[model samples]
Target: MRAGLATLVLLALAGYVFLHYQTGGARAPECVVTGTGTGEPYRLQPQQAANAATIQAVASSRGLPERAVTIALATAMQESSLRNIDYGDRDSLGLFQQRPSMGWGSEEEIMDPVYAAGQFYDHLVQIPGYTTMPLTEAAQMVQRSAFPDEYAKHEPQAAMLTAALTGRAAASLYCTSAMDPAPGDPGEIRGRLAHEFGDAVRTDHSGRDITVEVPEPELSPQGWEVAHWAVAHAAEFGVERIVHRDRVWEARRSVKGWQAAREQDTADGLLITVAP
Candidate 1:
């Protein structure tokens, strides 16, 4: 009787494995940000990835260092979990939970991720040596949250995101969706990219193919920075494939992450092929 029960259990477990592979393999469509070494990778939904990318983009636009990006990300993670939330403590709103009553901005401006991140950095840079300050202290100086210690918990995850979003980690960010979404609008993608990155990014689109090339990113970190941004936004933008130098990521095959490109194109900074 014991031997028969053991066989029955094995059969049940096998059935569960089959069901899971057949139905649960899609994984709910999310993006992952990884750092160097053996650190655990952090996962984020597409919307969260978009907000995090915006925070980093704003810092890059101001030519701020990576430390500024790290601080802003930690504060946002604590305040809104990197989401552009509409409700918050009292009148606080948006990614950084900036309160309009506190003169952060009008509600509409505060809701805009780019504007919110810019405001955070504007105050952050004014603090004496914020870059070198402890993560919680730097954030508290700008935020003044009731729980000044809350931001510290998010520092490690924020730094991991900073590395991927800032191009310090290459091919370290990717998204997986169930299937490709409908054909995406190149115009909308271009406009949103401009809204976040400003003049720092330039794209020339022919048909559904958009070439995102930065100026000599070899000397700058903007190459993979923009590349990873494209990957993070892939699900939202209906991006079908992305090519950066020797690496390639396809939406359908993104489960494999960034694979080696069959033909390397190191000259062009990045080639993004949206849904046709």
Candidate 2:
């Protein structure tokens, strides 16, 4: 069997074991999702967290419901452990393990998380009553995986992840970043935001920071959406601090999560301070 297929088998089994028994070796810079009124925080690796956030952003951009995000996350967790892998059961690739043979997309396109997620949603919406259907049922209708039932086990974890990444869980998602920082490219940051959020979000460059704006009414949830996405992509974008409402996440600090900004909110959008 191909290495990708072998890896998929091992990861799928490991995910099942980890979720079921809560046993796994520790990983550094873990992504913790909490405050969803659940039993405990759901943990993931940083890359998994990034992928999950991207999935949530893409779904939100398309005006899809939270149910769609839940279904997508659960499917991704089951298929690839939420990592954008280049290998899978057979010609499968990316977060959702979509296959070229199955007419999902070109290999290059499928590997792109934004494109892969869009495709997933496209197929999902066609399934009538999918929002009301059980997650496993909805996912199976789209994925048609050999092990159709496995998606069920991941829903609880996925739901928690969605809550935080979607900005519905307030400041529950957190991560640590390198103390040292470098100047970031505004163009690249804008490109990444547009790629993930489509046109729903706008970015402005000022010195070393980028101000991200969503439609007005800039409620806590929407503000947190931009803030958490900044945190999730902190390493990639050289983010130093993110301020939304009265809370802030500073990379050089020990909080490793959101904390009081110690100042009042004078703006309507998220202020992402990057290294200069």
Candidate 3:
């Protein structure tokens, strides 16, 4: 077998071990992010990946740089492990653990990942030179956490996530299809895309397949942004396959991560096929 195929075989086996390998009964949906040359992969529960996607989408909608994304991710990873949890120390809640008592937002608003991420950016941008400061310092200025340096520990992983989610690094993320008994709903995916990425995201649906046209106006982070987003939510949304540029990932074969797509799939935009 060729080198790439060999890599795929190993990765598929890895996926089997982590994704489908038995542990008591069954496994929850999961996503793995690599491609930072770290030689180590970062794993996320479906919910964590979904929350990170929201955070990245929020930053992109505001035209923030990758640095901002990295900072926000690290903060979220440190705060609540990227889950929109309902509780935290004291009154802290949501991904950033923003306390409603401290004026971040109402308890309901803060628990919404999109709202919470937006609130975090609203404060992040106000910092005079947040982009230039050290990651921990920038995060500290926004979140008055007791241990500021803790954010630094997650910076590397956060940076890796940023690269893949931002479209800077292609084909770096994939997930085992979530085993929802219901067939995937194209409309649901469309609405969620709009909610997190805004109505500006161009998309189309033909049955269970959703095609997202690359944001022609801005290619910098458009295509892969949606590509990774689709994959990260695959397990949660029942997405069976995703194709972008020259790569493809299938729910049934997710362990291979992103394999080289066939010649015919070499289109500009990407395609997402949901469970039937």
What tens-digit string does per-residue lDDT give for candidate 1 at 193-216?
888888888888999988887677
TM-score of 3: 0.86
Residue 75, model 3, lDDT: 98
Report the lDDT of model 3 for residue 193.
Answer: 92
Error of 1 at 212 (Å): 1.6
Error of model 1, residue 6, in angstroms: 19
Scored by Cα lDDT, where does model 3 land?
A: 0.85
1 versus 2: better lDDT goes to: 1
- Candidate with more favorable, higher lDDT: 2 or 3: 3
lDDT of 3 at 172: 78
Put down candidate 3 lDDT per residue, 1-276, tens digits, no spaces.
699999999999888787545641255567888855546988988789988988999888888899999999999999999988899999999999999999998999998888999999999999999999999999999999999899999988999999989988877777766444347899999999988888658799998889897855245567888888988887667788788777798776676678888898765677988998
Prediction-by-prediction clash tally:
0, 0, 1
Which one wins on TM-score?
Answer: 1
- Which one is best on lDDT? 1
Give candidate 3 regions above 4 Å deviation.
Answer: 1-28, 178-181, 215-220
lDDT sort, best first: 1, 3, 2
For each candidate in the order shown, give its overall lDDT on alpha carbons: 0.87, 0.82, 0.85
